[model samples]
Target: MIPPATAPLFLEQAGWPHAAIVPLAGDASFRRYFRVIEGGRRAVLMDAPPPTEDPRPFIAIAEHLCQQGFAAPAILARDLNEGLVLIEDFGDLRLKEYLEDQPGEELAVYARAIDLLADLHQRPVADVPPYDRAVYLREAGLLTEWYAPATGLVVDAPAYVAAWEAVLPLVEQGSAPVVTVLRDYHAENIMLIDRPEAKGFNAHGLGLLDFQDALAGHPAYDLVSLLQDARRDVPAETEAAMLAHYKAVATPGADFDAAYAILGAQRNAKIIGIFTRLWKRDGKARYLSYMPRMWGLLERDLAHPALAPVADWFAANIPADKRHDALVAFAPE
Candidate 1:
C-alpha cells in the first residue's frame, strides 16, 4: 500500500486526484507501483519512499537510456522529495508473460532482446558504480551469510572470500570494454513493445524496466543474467544462438565463453543467497521455488574449469544432495 502521506503528494504531483489507482506487481525492493487512470489516460506512479528507496538513480538511468535512443519510460512528473515519480506506462505485456502465452515466438523475441543488448554494449559505459571484484565478493558473500545459516551449515567467511578472490580474476582476463550493465537484465524486467520500423541493432522494440541498479561492468555479466535467469528457464539452443550472435557483433579479444561461465557461476551464487535471504529474512517463501533451477544453472557454470576454486568451495560446503530448497527442509512439519 502507498504510504498515507505519499498518496496525497503523488496525486498532487501527477494532477490525477480522481484517477483510479490500481496496485501493480512489485519487485524485491521497498518500492510500490500503481497504475493511475483518469479520463482514459494511463500512467504509472512509482512510490519509492525515501531513506529506504530513492528515485534519483532510476531517473538518471532512464534519461541515459533515452539519450541512447532506447525504450525506457519517460518521466512525466516527479517529486523526488517524496520519492514519487509519474512515468510512462508500457502496458501489461512483459516478455516473460508473452513467452508463456506464445512459446513458439520465444526465439524471435529473444533474438530481438539480444539485439538490444548488442546495441547497448556497443555504446560507452554510463556513469554508474563499477561491478568489480569487491562487488562480486560482497554479492557472493550473501550465500555464506544468509543461505548457510538458513540451512544447518556454518561457513568460514574469510575462506569464502579467499576462494572468490582466486576465481573472480578470470572474468577480468581478456575483458571487453565495460558497458552499462543493467544488473537485473532478464526476461521478467523486459517488456515487449510494438516498433516494427525501429532501426539498427539497438532498436526500441523492447521496453526496459527495473534498471535502477545498473553498473559499469563486463558485458558478459548481463548476458549471463539474461540466459541463466533465476525466475525462468531459457532454452539451451536459444542461449547458444544468442551467445554466438553476440560474439559475432561484439568487439574482439574477450573470451566471452569463459567469462560467461565464470560470471554465470558468480551470479547464480549471489542469487542462491539472495533467494535464501528473501525466504528466511523477508518471509517471502515463493522465491524458494526458483532454487532448484538456480542450482542447475550454478552447476552448469561450475563445470567450467575457470571456476574450480569456487566450485570446490561449493562442493565442500553445499553438497549436491543438500542443494535443494532450504525453506522446505526447515518448514514446520
Candidate 2:
C-alpha cells in the first residue's frame, strides 16, 4: 500500500503541512487511508485516487449519517483532483480486536451495533442509489465471475442469474421502509471510538467507517452484514441473541427472516468471490485465510427455506470438495 504520491501536498493544502503521515489501512477497493498527526490533533486522509475510485459518495454518505445523528466520521477538508479527503480519525481500536481481547463483551457490543441499525432503519433513507435487481445480480454474479474460474469450474451462469431472479422479489417484499444500508457493517469496519459520540441511536462510541458503498436497501441487509460477518467469527448464540434483540428493538417486516437469509447468502457469496479475486487477481493471499469462514457463513444462510433456488444452484454447481473443505487445502500459485 504505497502512500499516494500526492498525499503530502494534499495534507499541506488541507492545513496539515507539517503533520506526520502514517499508513492507516486499505480495503478491498482502490482507496487507501493514512493517519495525519500534528501536535495533538489528528485526522484520517482518505486517498481515493480517480479513474478507479471516487470520494464523493463517501463524503455525501458521511454528511448524511451525521445529519441523521449517526456516527460516520466527519469530513474536514477535500481535494477532488487528487481524490483526497481529510476527515476525523477514530484511533486504532475496532470491535473485532476489542472483542477478541475480551470475548465476554461480544453479546453486549453486538447488541449495541444491532441497536444502531434499528435506529437507522427507523430514519429517512439517504439520497443514494437504490439496491435494486441490477445491483443484486451484479453482486451475486461475482461468484461465477471470479471464484468459479479461480477454482477451474465451469459454472452455469445463466441458471445462477435465474435462481437470483426467482428469489430477489422475496427480498423486495422485506425492504419495507427502506433505509440506507451501510454495506459493510461488520466488526472490523466498526471502530470503538474513545471520543464522545452522537447521543441518539445508541451509537455509544461506535465510530462508523467504510460506508462509501452505502445504498438505499432493505433493513435486513445491514443486519445480515453485521451478524454474518466474513472476517470475524460471531458466535451462533450471540448472532441469534442479537437478532432477537433487533426484532425487539425495531419493527421488522413479516418476511424479515426470508429477507435476512437471502441477503446473507448474497453477501456471503459476494464476499467469497471478492476474497478469491483478491488472491487470484490482486495477489493478496491474506484474504484467502478468511474464505473458510465465509463458506461457513454462506452455508448457514443457505439453510433458510427462502434460499432454495440459490442453494440449489450452489449444490448443483459448487461441489463439496471444491467448496469450503477444498478451499481449506487450496492456495494460490
Candidate 3:
C-alpha cells in the first residue's frame, strides 16, 4: 500500500514532510490509511481516490459530528482534488478487538455507544442524503442482483420488491423527524481511546470513524447495525440488554421496535449480498466468512412479525439449505 506520489508534497505542505508515514490497516473500500508521525505526535492520512470514492462527504460529516460534540476524528488537512486528508489518530483499539480481549466489558461498552446514539438523536439532523424507501430497496436489491445469482438460484426479483413494498411504509412512517444515521455504526468502526486527561472531551470515550455515508433516517437503523454486526458475534443476551438500554434511554417513537426489526433484516440482507459481491467481483474471499453470521442474524430478524412478507419471499425463493455460502462459494463462477 504505497502512498500516492504527491503524498510527500501534501504532507510537507501540511508541515509533516519528514514525518515517518506508517501504513495502517484498510477497510472494504478503495481508501487506504497511513499514520504520519512527527514531533512525537501522530495523524491519520486518508487516501480515497476519486470516481469510485468521494472524500467530500467524509469531510463534511466529520466537521458536523465535531460541531455536535461527538468523537469523530478531527480533520487536520485536506486536498479534495487529490482525494487525500490528514486527520487525528485514534490509536489501534478498535471496539471489536478490544471487546474480544475483555468480554466482560461488552455490555458496558455497548451501553456507552447506545447512550451516544441517544444524545445524537436529540441533536438536529445533519445535511445528508435521505435513507429513503428507494435507497432501502436498492440496498436490499444487492441480494437479488449479486448473491442470489452467484448462488445459482433464480430468486424472484419481482416478489422481492413486492415484499419490501409492503414493509417499507412502516419504516417510512416510523422514521419521522429524521436524524443522522451513521450507516456503518458497528464495533469495527469505533475506536476505544485512552484519553485519561481529556476523557471529558468524549464523554462516551469512543472515537467514531467511516461515517461519511451518514444518512437522515430512523434512529433504530444504527442500533441494528451495532447489535447485529456481521464482523463479530455480539452475544444474544448482550443484544437483548442493549436493545432494552437503548429503548429506555432514547424512548423513541412507538414504532421503534417494528422499525428495528425491519431495518435489521434489511441491513443483514444487504450485507450478505455485499459480502458475496466482494468475493465474486472484487476477489476478496475473506468477506465470505461473514456470510454465515449475516444469515443467522437475518433469520433472527425475520422472526419479527413486521418482516413477514420479506421473510415469506426469502423462504420461497431461497430455501433454508440455500441461504448460505455452500451453494454459492462452490458454484460455477
Candidate 4:
C-alpha cells in the first residue's frame, strides 16, 4: 500500500489518479511498485522510500544500460526526493513466469539470458562499487551471524573468516576479466523483451531488472546467480549446456569453471544467511521454504576443489541433515 503521506505527491508526479493505480508485487527490498493507467497508457511507479533506499543508483544504472543498447526500462518521470520514479512498464511477463508457462522453452530462454550476460561482460564497469574481497567476506559472514543463531549453532567467527579468506583469493585469481556484475541476475529479475529484429545472440531481446545492487566484479558471479538460482530449480544438464555456450562465446579462460564454482558457493552461502535474516529480522517466513534448495546449491558448489576450506567449514559447522530450514529446525514444539 502506498503511504498516505506520499500518495498524493506520487500520483501528481506520475499524472496518475487514485482510481488508475494498482499495486504490484514487491521484491525483497523496501521498494514498492504500482501499475499506473492514465488514458489507457501504462507506466510503472516505483516508490522507494527514503533512508532505507535511494532511487539514484537505479536511475543511473537504468540510463547506463539503455546507453549500452540493452532493454532496460526508460525513466518517464522521477522525483528523487520523494523516492518515486515513473518508468516504462515491461508488462507482466517476467522470465520466470514465461518459463513457468512454457516449460519447453526453458533452454531457449536461458540461452538468451546467457547471451545477454556475454554482451554485458564485453562492456567495462561503470559507476558502481567494486565487488572486492572485503565485500565478499562481509556478505558471506551473514551465514555465521544469522543462520547460526537461527539454527541454534555457535560458529567460531574467526575460523569462519579464515576459511573464507583462504577461498576468496582463489576466486579472484581464477575469474574472468572484471565487468559490471549484476548482483542478482537470476530468472526472477529477467524479462523477455519483444524485439523481433534484434540481431545476434548478444542483442536486446532480454530485459534487465533489479540491478540497483550491481557492482564491478568477476563475470562468473552473475553466471553463478543465473544457473544456480535460489528461487527456482534449473536442471543440471541445462546449466552445463548454458555454461558451455557462454564459454564458447565469451572465451573466458579454463579457470572459469573454478571461479564459477567458488562464486556460486559464496553466493549461496550469503543467501542462506540472508534468508535466515529475512525470517528472523524482517519477519518474512516464505523465504524459509527456499532454504533447502539453497543448501543443495551450496553443497554442489562446495564440491569444487577450490572451495575445500570453505567446504570444510560448512561440513564441520552445518551437518548435512541439519542444513534444512532454520526456522523449522529450531522451532518451539
Candidate 5:
C-alpha cells in the first residue's frame, strides 16, 4: 500500500491541481479506496496494486455497464501507470448500514435493490466471459484446501468436492438468461445517496461498488446474493416475498422459485468453502463464526422439494453432529 501523502502527490503529478485523500474501508482485497472531496465535489480515489490487483478490466467493465444504462461510477481521472483512478463519489452509507437504521423499511429498500438487479440482469453482454465449470470447481477447491485444514478436520475430500459437484446439474438446469451480473451485489457494496429528483423506488439513489468481478451468468445468482446473505439473518417469508417481487418483473421462462433454490444452494456451497479457506489460509476465524448461519441458509434452500435430493445427500454424508463439531472447532473465540 502506498503512503497517504504519496497518493495525493501522485495525483498532483498527474495534473490534478490537488486532491483530498481520505481512505475508505476495503475488504480482503489489495484494492484501497479514498474519498477525494475537492472543489466542493466528491470523487472516489482507487489505489489498486497493479502487480497483484489489475484495475484495467474492472475499469473497462464499469465503463461498458455505464454505456448500457446502469449506475456505475464515472471515471473522472486515471493514472494507469500508478494504478490509481478518480471516480464520482456515491456517499458514505452502505446498504448494510442503511438497512440497520431503517428497520421499518428494510423490505422496501431490498425491493429497490432487487429492482436494480433486475435491470442489471436484463442487460445483454454477449461478449463478456461466462463463469464456466473450471472456475466453479476451483472455487469449491478453496474450501477443501483452506477451511478443512483450519477446522483441523481431515475433511472427506471426495465428500466435500462431491458435495458441491452434486449441485452442478441443478445449476445448469436452472440457468436464467445470461447477463452481466455484479457478482457481489450485496448490501455492503451499495451506497445510499441523496437524489430528490429520482422518484418512487428511487427516493434514495443507490451507489454500486465492488463490481469488477461482474460476469455473464444466471440472472437469479445475484438475487440469492442479496436474499441468502451469509452475514445476516433474512427471514424465510421475506425471502419468499422478495422472490415473488423479482418474479413479477423477470422474463418469461425464468422459474423464480427453482432458480432461487439452485442459486441459494450454489452460493452457500461456495461460501462454506470460502469461510473455511478464510480461517485456514488467512488465519481469520471471524468468517468461521458465520458458517452455522450459512449452513442454515443451505438447510432452508434444501427444504425446497426440488433441492431435496442434494439436501438428503448432504445430511446423509455430512451429518448434523459432525457439522456441529466443525462449527465449534473454528468459530471465533
Candidate 6:
C-alpha cells in the first residue's frame, strides 16, 4: 500500500487535481492497483513494486498494440521511476461472470473471442521477444519442485527432465507461424462490456485485461489456453469448432493438432506446478481446489496420440489415484 503522503505526490504528478484513491482488487503478485475516479471519468492507477515488477513491458506493449489498432487499455500517464501508471479502466464485467447467466450462448461468445485472437496472431511475430526454450523448461521444471514436495512423492526428476527434452524436437518441428501470443488468454482475463456505441454483433465482445505479460509465442499455445481452460468445462464439439475456425483463418499449412496437444501437455504440467506453489509457498490454498480440474485437462491433453512419450512417462512415474490427494493437501479446506 502506498502511504497517504506519497499518494499526493502521484496525483500531483499525473495532474489529476485532488484525486481520491481507492484500493482495487489484486491477484497473486506484489503489485497493487487502485481505481481513481474524478468528475465522473474513471481511470486505474497501478502501484507496482520496483525491482520485483517492471512497468516498461506494460508501457511498451500498450503503446505497440494501440498503434496496431487493438483494444488495449489506454495509458493516460506514468511515473516509471516510482512504478506508477494511470490507465483507462476497461470496466469490471469479466467473461467468466458473463457466461454464468447465459451459459447457452457460450460457444457464440467464444467464436467472437477467437476472431479477436486470430487478428492478434496474424500480426508479425518479430515485433516481440521470443517465448524461448529456457523459459519453457524453467516453467515445466516447477512441476518437480512443487508437486513432489507437496505430495511427499520423490518424483523421478531425471525422467521428468528427459520427457521434456524429448518434447523439444517435436515442438520445434511442429512450430507454426509465431504471433504476439497473450500468455494467459483464458476466460478469466477477458471482460464483457456493453457495445452501446458500436454497430455490430461483436461490438460488446470483450475487453482484454492483464495482458501486460504478453509475449511472442506459438499460435497454438493460446488456442489451447482458451479451449482447454481448466476452470470451465468446454465441450469437445465446441473445442473442435473453434479449432476449425482458427485453421480456416490460418495460412495453408499442415494441421497442427499434434503440436497443439504437445503444447497443452506442456502448459498443464506447468500449471500444476503453479497451483502447488500457490498453496505451499504462498499459503493461498483456494487455488488447490482447481487442481483436479487442471489434472483432468492435462490427462485429456496427454491422451492425444502425438504426446505418447510425455504421457507414458507420466503414467509410469506418477500413480493416478494418488495425484488428486497430493494436490488437495495444498488446497484450502
The lDDT per prediction is: 0.83, 0.86, 0.88, 0.83, 0.70, 0.76
Better of 3 and 6 by TM-score: 3
Native-referenced Cα lDDT, model 5: 0.70
Error of 1 at 49 (Å): 0.7
lDDT of 1 by residue, 1-333 (tens): 654366765776568878777888677888988888889788888988898999999999998998898988888889888888988888788899999999999888888888888889888678999888889999988888888887778767787788889977767664577789998999899987685532211455789999999998788888898989898989999899888887887763467687889889889989989988877877777788888889889899898888888788888887766786545654433
Using lDDT as the measure, name the better of candidate 3 and candidate 5: 3
For candidate 6, the per-residue lDDT at 314 reads 84
| Each prediction's TM-score versus the true structure | 0.94, 0.95, 0.96, 0.93, 0.86, 0.91
Candidates' RMSD to native:
2.5, 2.1, 2.1, 2.8, 3.2, 2.6
- Can you write out model 4's per-residue Cα lDDT over 1-333, one digit (the tens) per residue? 754367666677566765377788677878988887778678788888898889999988988888887888888888888788888787777888899999999989898898888998997576999899999999998999999887778878899899889978765764358788888999888877675632211264777888988898888899999999999999999999999999888957657888899899889989999988888988777888888899889999999998999888888888765686546653333
Clashing pairs in 3: none
lDDT of 6 by residue, 64-142 (tens): 7666666667788888877888887877777777788888888888887788788777765535677778777888888
Steric clash pairs (candidate 5)? 147-276, 147-277
Q: Which digits, one per residue and each the tens of the lDDT, describe model 2 over residues 145-185?
A: 99898788998999999999999998787546688899999
Better of 3 and 6 by lDDT: 3
After superposing all C-alphas onto the true structure, candidate 6 shows an RMSD in angstroms of 2.6
Task: Tell me which of candidates 2 and 5 scores higher on TM-score.
Answer: 2
How should the candidates be ordered by TM-score, best one leading?
3, 2, 1, 4, 6, 5
The alpha-carbon root-mean-square deviation between model 4 and the true structure, to one decimal in Å, is: 2.8
Worst 10 residues of 3 by lDDT: 324-333
What TM-score would candidate 6 get against the native? 0.91
Candidate 1 residues lying further than 4 Å off, grouped into runs, are 2-4, 195-202, 329-333
Off by over 4 Å in 2: 197-203, 328-333
TM-score of 3: 0.96
